[model samples]
Target chain A: MGKDQILVRVRDLHKVFHRGSERIDVLQGLNLEVPRGDFLAFMGPSGSGKTTLLNLIAGLDRPTQGAIDVDGQRIDQMSEADLARWRARHTGFVFQLYNLLPVLTAERNVELPLLLTPLSRAERKRHVQTALSVVGLADRAQHYPRQLSGGQEQRVAIARAIVADPTLLLCDEPTGDLDRKSEDEILDLLQALHREYGKTVLMVTHDPHAAARAQRILYLNKGTLSAEPIE
Target chain B: MRFWPLLWSSLWRKKVRTTFTLLSILVAFLLYGYLAAVNKGFSLGINTGADRLFLRHKVSLSILLPESYLGRIGATPGVVDVVHATWFAGIYQEPKNIFPQLPVDPERYLRLYPEFLLPEDQKQAWFADRTGAVAGRTLVEKFGWRIGDRIPLVSPWRKQDGTSTWEFTLRGIYDGAAEATDTRQFLFHYDYFEEARMFGKGMVGWYIIRIHDPKRAAEMAQRLDSNFANSFHETKTMTEKALVQGFARQIGDIGTIIGAILTAVFFTILLVAGNTMMQSVRERTAELAVLKTIGFSNHLVLTLVLTESLLLAGLGGVVGLGLAYWAIERGDPTGGVLPVFFFPPNDIVLGGVIMVALGLATGILPALQAMRLRVVDAIRRA
Candidate 1:
């Protein structure tokens, strides 16, 4: 694979869930590709399997019968242990609710993923400082999630997601719980991460405005992915 | 950044719940310490010197042995010296007031038991007057007895008529060399008892023999018993440790009782702790999913939960045992019912082990549940 080539390759992926004796098919023969350093957003209705597709790409869930290749690794076929290591090294995640550990301070929360790495204490401290500075939460490093406002908490969550310098950053409705002003700030941060740091981004959201901030937008309709023209 | 700080804060997140849980664990370990001391007191004979042997009547401890057999026992090949004593079972003030009132050959008894530390003046006073007695320091303090104070003694076995009643002047108060040694015994001259008693004049309760070599105790015991074999009153000779252990066993199986009580206590504690851990993990379901999404492996999550549980239980255990040690040092909260209570170092070690085991047992299920959580579902629920 060459530079600026396809970084994620999904071919005919299907995901089905079984509730007792009833089978619910979430995804049906989906195919998609994301170029290196591209910021792609997914918009879909409820139960349309946009989150399922993102989870599969992030190595958090397995596909029923298909192939998912991220960073040149067939993550769908990886064991649970190997997949976890893979996720740690290559993937960062931002949740809609900002998913910051309530007991930890903002800096400590950002340093969570770095614990999986072999970095020294000084190195980890530097990385945490950098991540917090990038998100404009350097002064709020000592504040816990409960101590910060909604937008500040999301910034800390974003800092935590990017602290380890993961190859891909997956956001699940990153602005779902934020006001318009906070959403604009978070969208600007995501744009800066993609343009300045050359980070690949995949986000699943229901808001068209959140999708419009991405370089490319895909709509999931009737279990099939289709590009929506950005005007 | 480190697992330690994360675990510490997680446990303290709900201060009230954690404090109460810790208090329960503290109570459990405190009970463990005191119960362990009581068990140690009941099973009190394993620490005796092997050179000593106690020879008693084979039929029963209450049965009398012939005093003439003492000479033969002393003449045995391995015998160093033979001392004889008889229980007077005397009561003072009321029937509830009880103490060891044994009459012994004072010189021989004191020589055999060097652990009973007595002053030279007290020894001479007892030997000087046949009607004088030596009491332990604890007994003297407990009853406020002073030197030259005549103590009236009554025996239930013997009718305490005017002539049959006994009185002795307290001449000395003895201390114990070691904590396990009993310092509450009342030792008087056997010559006085033999002369004053109406019946069983030449009979003694038991004979204590000191051997030159402790390893030769079994051989000497066999030789002494064989000498009294088929005689008027046969003898059963055993090491002093074994004899004390037998007496302890006759009361009840203290070790088994302690084990059962501790088992019940720990089982209830396990349920309480396990329920708390389960609730904690359950409430943090969404947070755990966030951890997994951020690349925390399943094993790390499980270990984090377990470590939190261990920290909670271990903190409580140390505090509780520290309190127990303090109480033991303060001495007999029950006011002398348990005379030989002590908190041995080994009991502290055992309590620590129980704390760790309880932590593991209570945390394993909840930790596994945390490990098996599906990140997608947890995030969805949140």
Candidate 2:
């Protein structure tokens, strides 16, 4: 799709958090456009607020001073419940540590997001199985988190993110906790999902190689977005 | 929601802690059940005690009234029949082997309660012989008293010439037809003790009046008491229930004390279980935060945590109730004091309700924390 078919559009977005005595500005007058099916990466230092901007785009948090439109809906103005339902229908998320509930097996962890929808048990099982198979962990579906290796757990997390058939996929330091080999494997999975399934992936990371795997790389410094050149 | 598997796995994770929690709930509910059953154990009106009421001398229970009063009281209004008795306050050959020995009029006593299942032939044989006695089933088993055998009871009050054995033949052993009273008392002919003639001459300790309508008992007691008031001896009459309860109250306010203890126990369980749920939810802060960021509604998260806590409590409650059932069924050290001891159905239901309430109340703190946590901070906690 063209840039006119942007999946995420932010206009002068700002976020401020209250910590005991004063306010801390995380995102200051940010702007961005993410087209449908584009693999994009946001690279920044620890306190640069890249994740804050992603949360706004994913409808996870409200921006204090601006508007965010994701797939034609202005999410900043939606009610918490509406935003949650919208996020369930439109957004998917992956984290560095996988964040899988230790108690659930791989398939059940993948099946978590589907529980929010009105899908039948069979439909849920099918979705979980397909997602796990997509991540090449179909055989590991019955294994608990403790039974899996780190990279395997992350792949399961990715499977969970996409199980709901969401429009936007968000990853926060998706390979920050993995070894180089595992990181490359994860980047490969992200690339495959983007290229084959045509998913819109917004990743935040410090690793340049991870960003190089994206169709576009953007830099965020002190709550402002800038361009980045990937080799 | 599909949270059951999550809860089950979480409970199974730390086996020792889970087991400890379950056991704690078990013990708590056991105490609750026993206390509740102790409350139920006070129900009287069975076998030996229910069918009889001691119409004591008007001045005091210990005061001996003349035999002439018994004939008159038996003919009073609402009176079906009457039996007169004197407490021997005896011990079996040994000083420590104490028991209540009663000198009773067998003929009229046999007419009062038809539920005391004794053979007609045995009753006739015992009533014909002056020195015959009928022991309760429990008493018979207790002392191995057989039919046509002699039981020598030593009375402390009616001793004569330093000898106290009031020997009587055990013509028959009887069983009570109700569930309440213990079958552990002894009954025999009063003429035997009176015929000894060494003590209590022409006098009876008390009279027991069996009424036709137990509901009109209060008025009957009043009539019985007024009939003998201001005489050389006076009578204090009461219903069989009131008399039994009065005897129990003489010990202490056990039911009230038990009620206070149960209230305290329930409060403690609520706090302890609530605190436990709070700690568990706190431990899952980051996970809950992740749920929020993934678009779980504040309400869903709140309900999820609360349900998790209640699930824990519910599981604990079932185990506790089960343990309580076993303990009560097996009996306690209070041995036969709580004979009808069992947890009431409502108590188990109450436990369920309290578990849900305590779990929800405690979970609210952690859930609110989760709902209020900044989404950015939540994910940042990593």
Candidate 3:
């Protein structure tokens, strides 16, 4: 793929963690490329470095070695402050637990990322309304997280992730804690975000059903990726 | 300003905890306000007058000074005028009803202390009637003593006929020019007191001397004291402010005592407030990590936490000081002991500064912890 076509390029990546005096290597010699608007999923057992790789790509963790270039900018070498600014402009994140600030209503939760921007209050309100409407939670704008079901809260989280109109959407087990019906709904939302919105999506999930919805699936084993799917 | 709602909401996330913490801070500041007012009252003389000097018996305040020494003091250089007053240890109705009753030459005393605002008619009325007395507005109101009413006081000093009661008609009520001025005194003509007394007829409690230049007051005081240094009654001369401070010091080191109490209170409050912020941050670790994931910088997170703390302290402090001011306005609780009782403006400002300092002291550690939190670890732990 052309350099412009590839949105994320990871080369010779390594990640190490330490617990007291013991050393544990999470990811080693990992290389991957994600094309623009591609829906990619990483599947592996727990402790197989699937989430670690996703974290590195999202600039939430720095690699022990090698480089990460996102949209032609070398993110691995960027300072923490610079990475934060880049993330604000280019990335959105959705977690499995649907991490919504419980004290805030759905509308306010969706407005979180917009607060970082210099958008006028009216403009931010419009953006939040549109993001909530896109997630089909417009009618529940004033409902707090405690007032909503697991599926509804996850929908609110998705609205927050997209409120800022970021370039990359990273999901770590986005539907891991949901019921089967809720899981299908979230996966459908993710697919719509990718196919309809043309978002570059990277997700880490252990569920084969969730993995199958992605355009490409990579199995992480022994700190490397392969085309074969995990059982 | 845009983030105020977020900071406010975070502060009250745990309603019970926040309410208790707020009450704790309120009580502490309220105590601070009362103690600071008391300290100000005790040290009121420091702000009284720089140009006026007081001359008393060098041996002790209880020891009387000869009234004849007033002429010698007035003759000294830098002395503009001199007046004398003798303490009348008198009580009204009951012994518990205590207040300052002084016998002074009405004209001279009124001329020297102009802060005592009395009407001209009342001054003439007092001078015309030999048995006339003028009471401060505060004392007049306390005992419901109206002008033209005859009030009798029981004194330990007896008349030549062995009677312990003295009667005088209330001629006027004097108001204080400033809020902190002691308006609880009762002043009457000294000639009547001298004629009625059985002994020590030519003695006075203290002499108040006005000088030409305030800056040379210490030098003038030394000159005045030397005039009586070798006489039967040696004298000590000092500024009126020093005399008031000396009287207050007899009660103990009020400033140090109040300071020690306030220090203990604030330290305890610091621990309580600090632990509260620490717990609040710890409980919201996952939420803070999510905020970071959404592109909030570490500095922004730190600011949010610190702002939350400041809001808490500021709210409690403003309300506490406000309540204390209201209580002080209601009047002194200690009947007549603390005559000059009111919260000073400077103390209110100091309270505000302490509130900010307390907030910063308690918020810093927790804010730093929030700032240094690694997003992945916090998320995983949560």
Candidate 4:
């Protein structure tokens, strides 16, 4: 509980989903902690609740019953409005589909999160340029999502995530839609962002190859977390 | 970087659908503008000052009053001058070619209507020759009539030797001196008309009186009507505005009809535009979810949806209003109902208000749906 020792903590987390008369528990009494600057990956079967735990930790979904402490704040108790503000200031997300806006070019897409900030126009532009450069997509800043290759689009999404310099990076199946070469390129970019910026990363994926790149890998089976990382 | 570029790009993402929706909106607003002008024209008369009063037979305008009423009306204390006219009901060539033709005492009538500017020489010529007539500039231009040309009018009221045709030599063309003055009349000598008519002799259709003070118009109208009350031919005296409004009312309930038509039109537009907005929002569910994840508040997402729909409507509304204005400026192409029509500033303002309201109405439900969408659910659906 010392300052800077831990970035995210969870205790007895439970998530339930209901369909008509049937109730399904996605996560049950989950307990874990992610220290600052650690890159953790969650891998499980499709219905093993790996993604649900990731969403809960990222404050993207509310847990049915549990405590989610991220950056010393109990996000489980935060209001939707407050959660959005907290997410803006503390978390960045990357999804399997790259999820970049099709209409905007790479630079403007990277500038999206900065728009929510109080940064001046010049400062925002410089930050956007730096983020794009870090992802090695500087020359393709003006290219739209459709104009970029799969790897390039994922790189743009990564640039968008880190543009506002959030402390926590939550990625969901980042390489789920890419080929082997593209997946390797994205994995490399994520590793560089984590090592250079000291970002705390939690990624959910079905690919063990993608998981092996993380500093520590955890397994979720039947809504429960495990210490073992299987190749 | 600004909100506008996002809004603009989102609105035009489906260019074909947006363009068609905008065209429909444009057409609706165009109808709104032009119909407003037409409605105004139908309900409004020449904006005469309060000094003018029209006296017609109480039973109906077609019922004529005795010629002796002229002198009595002029003798009234507040009345400065009185001029009487009889409807000629003349058809120029075809039966469909109909316009207002009246026979009046030229000298007196000209004095009463200072807005009709006629040349002194032409006035003298029209007065000297009983067969000569004066036409407005609009009438002359419409029929391509010139001075010294004999214009034949087929009269339904009178016939001479089995033919109902009467011919008059066009002597002069007068123009309107003021904004409200109508430049579409055909006037000739009342003396010649009275002497030649086979029946209804010595009777005039209506009397036009000019008073000294506008404040006394209602009092004068009441007093004048009372003077002819209980007589063989009772009189109804009213100001020129009331008289014109009465005539327009006799045609139909213009306000209600226009209101009903506009309501139907706008309601149809609302449904069509609302459906488009809903479809647009539904297609962008994942994008909206992405926005929420990126720290866009629920209210901000709602505003973005509303702003995009409003921009679509606003674009169409402006273009529609412009087309309406252009069409009105070129005058009514039909060249029948609306003789001289233009879109008033008030109507333009009204159309703009309708456009904005329509945008809000069409956008609200879809925006609300977008606002209430769960990011997790939205992303899953996408």
Write one digit per residue (lDDT tens) for candidate 1, span A129-194.
Answer: 999999998999899899999999999999998999999999999999999999999999999999
For model 4, residues A1-231, the per-residue Cα lDDT tens digits are 576698998999999999999999999999998999999999888889987888888788999999999988999999989988888888899989988888888988898888889998899889999999999999998898999999999999999999998989999999999999999999998999889889888999999899999999999987889987543
Write candidate 2's Cα lDDT for B1-382 as tens digits. Answer: 4766766775565567667666666677667776766665664442244435568866678888888987798788778888787877776666755555677877676677665678889988888888888877756765677899877777765545557677888888777775444465677777777777577788888887888777677778888888877887877887666766675577666678877887787677767766676666666666776676667788887777677667766777777777777776675345433334556666667767766776676567766776676666665665
lDDT of 1 by residue, B144-245 (tens): 999999998887435324364688999998998877777778999899888778788789999999998898888888989999999889989999889867
Error of 1 at B281 (Å): 1.3
Say which prediction, candidate 1 or candidate 2, comes out ahead on lDDT: 1
Ranking by lDDT: 3, 1, 4, 2
Candidate 3 lDDT at B274 equals: 95
Quality of candidate 1 docking, DockQ = 0.63
Q: What are the TM values for chain B, all candidates?
A: 0.83, 0.75, 0.94, 0.81
Worst lDDT 10-window in candidate 4 chain B: B332-341
Candidate 3 residue pairs in clash (backbone atoms < 3 Å): none
Cα displacement (angstroms), candidate 1, residue A186, comes to: 1.3
Best by TM-score: 3
Q: What digit string (tens of lDDT, one per residue) describes model 4 on residues B155-274? A: 976843556788899999999885345677899988888877778888999999999887888999998898899999999999988887777788887778888988998999999899
* Model 1 misplaced stretches (Cα beyond 4 Å): A1-4, A20-23, A229-231, B46-52, B57-66, B75-81, B87-203, B210-253, B334-339
RMSD of each: 4.7, 4.9, 2.6, 4.8
In TM-score terms, candidate 4 sits at 0.82
Off by over 4 Å in 4: A120-123, A229-231, B46-52, B59-71, B74-204, B209-223, B230-233, B238-242, B249-255, B334-339
DockQ values per model = 0.63, 0.56, 0.72, 0.57
Evaluated on chain A only, model 4 obtains a TM-score of 0.97
lDDT of 3 by residue, A65-99 (tens): 98999999999999989888888889999999999
